[model samples]
Target: MDCLAGSARAVPRWRNVAGASRTGKPVIVPGLIVANVAVFVLTVVTAGSLNRNFASPWFAEGALVPALVANGEYWRIVTSGFLHVGPLHLAFNMFALWIIGREVETVLGRARFVAVYGVSLLGGAAAVMLLSNPLGPTAGASGAVFGLMGALFVLLRRLKLPAGQVIGVIALNVVISFTIPQISWQGHLGGLVFGAAVTAALVYPGAVAQNRRRVQIVAISGLALLGLLLIGAGAAFL
Candidate 1:
């Protein structure tokens, strides 16, 4: 099966729509993996005994985590997605993305994939801000990965695909989350929920494509609102 097949298989089924080379092929997702790997090399090399936040460039942040720290940077919300605390961390997440992202992006198209990813990242960030101690910082692409998985099954359901395996895949990750320390459970769960919502809205049949658009707009708006609220709340604590 192709990239689109993997995503659609995660839960429900959605047919493929042909596109240009970028969205039609499998290169973009792996390219992202390479980019992330390159960044991690820099992070590990820099994060010696002297600097605790050496890998700060990899984590994502905004008004909440970065805004609180004196030396913290603001663009972490996007940057953090590229950073991994250890080889294992990076490998696992990248692998998951490669397997899931390719198919989802292929099916959703690049622009929509980007949209789904961005919303999921924000959703992950929002969850961290709301639940975690404001003073503490959380980062990783697992949230984004989790988001993709959630999207797969939900998207399939909307298109009338089988959803039997989706729950199993999700539960496996959740088990890993509880068993793994320093893993961002908030981010994972948050991203998963956000991705599902977005995919569901996008693919959900409503008698008219316009209705689907309405569903997506409302869902995206809700996630954005929640992220902004977390930013505000984090600022308050600081």
Candidate 2:
């Protein structure tokens, strides 16, 4: 039920051609990179300081603060994925995205790649709402970047590619997530798990015969609903 299952079974001649073309160009990845960078530039231009912008209205409005989200700022879940606290943060996340995102986008294609990223972003926001400080704000693309890592991990393994490097990167990032101050380990963990789940659903063998597009839509919708529920619960409990 993998996205590439049909392609994998193609005749040898076609397989080589497909492989070459698949790796040749990725449309969504570049657009995503550009969008993230553009948003960061806007944030920096408006906020004046890369490292400290909590005082900036964009940060205040876009960052995932449980209290604000609970009070009806639901858009933060998506917007926060585009905002970064500093250049270092943006650079690290965008770099990871550039390296990993292009590969994943190539494999998943544009639409599915977008779905995985959106789910990962919402999943991270849900984790922040549920487990992070209700009053503190969290912002970055790390969550969605981590999500891409999870999806890539599954994808590489499925293709019989060496996934040791992916596993190693995830392990290293997990360690950093816990040790780094102000980092949202919850968001990272949430995005990783959610991304894996979503990707698995997307590539499920049973879905190969079914309407794959419909399946992807359902899976993404379910994830989005779950994220909303988590946000509601967080608001209620925390």
Candidate 3:
């Protein structure tokens, strides 16, 4: 699956859109970008080519292959998200992550943002395992980036900000996913669905302000469990 689907325009600053003070500076977003870049560099060094990192042993070990996952190499679901096919793929995905991830991190705080990102990555892998060719290897952060995009849309709607641009961007990406060969629409759609659902749980915890945190905990836990169940079921299919 191609990691760099396209450039998804960044959302306007939350403070500008929602008139709320900034909650936190972005810590996790930068860290994630660095991690992805570092992994890409290592893949290039090992493979001795910028565009052919797939030839690297790192790719062999990390890229998600459903048959291997079924054989119990379960860590591919996480590592594959960090691997990329080429420099261009890595660049585009990191750019999208910087643009979209920082805003989501600022709004959700570190712990919650990490939770959503981790689960969304797994959700994407689960979809791939369940639907894509069992022997084909897939890698990249597109799925997680798509997840962040989905989260950003939910956040904008929650703040009552104009979401026309976000909706258009998402629609455009969905179109690209279908038109472009080698793109994993299954992973993209899975991440989007799970990310939006997880963010909705966080932002829409019902009445009773004092119990909002408690409600968020329950909701996020439930979603995480659901993601795990999906992953396990996908493995069974593999």
lDDT of each: 0.68, 0.79, 0.80
Q: Model 1, stretches more than 4 Å misplaced?
A: 1-22, 48-73, 205-207, 210-222
Record all residue pairs in model 3 with backbone atoms less than 3 Å apart, i.e. clashing: none
| Candidate 2 vs 3: which has more lDDT | 3
Q: Judged by lDDT against the true structure, how good is candidate 1?
A: 0.68
Better of 1 and 3 by TM-score: 3
User: Which runs in model 2 stand beyond 4 Å of their true positions?
Assistant: 1-24, 208-210
Q: Compared to the true structure, candidate 1 yields what TM-score?
A: 0.78
Task: Assess the local accuracy of residue 51 in candidate 1 as a C-alpha lDDT between 0 and 100.
Answer: 33
The alpha-carbon deviation from the true structure for residue 21 of candidate 2, after best TM-score superposition, in angstroms, is: 10
The 10-residue segment of model 2 with minimum total lDDT is 14-23
**Clashes within 3 Å, all models in order:** 11, 1, 0
- The alpha-carbon RMSD values of the candidates against the true structure, listed in the order shown, are 4.8, 4.1, 5.8
Better of 1 and 3 by lDDT: 3
- Cα lDDT tens digits, model 1, 71-173, are 4454666676776666777788898999889778877767667767878887787677666666666656888889899888776665566667777889989
Model 3 error, position 142 (Å): 0.9
User: By the TM-score metric, which is better: model 1 or model 2?
Assistant: 2
lDDT of 3 by residue, 144-222 (tens): 8889889988887876667788888899999998999988898888888888888888777784656777887887788
- TM-score of model 2 relative to the true fold? 0.87
Question: Against the hidden reference, what TM-scores do the models get?
Answer: 0.78, 0.87, 0.89
- The TM-score of candidate 3 is 0.89
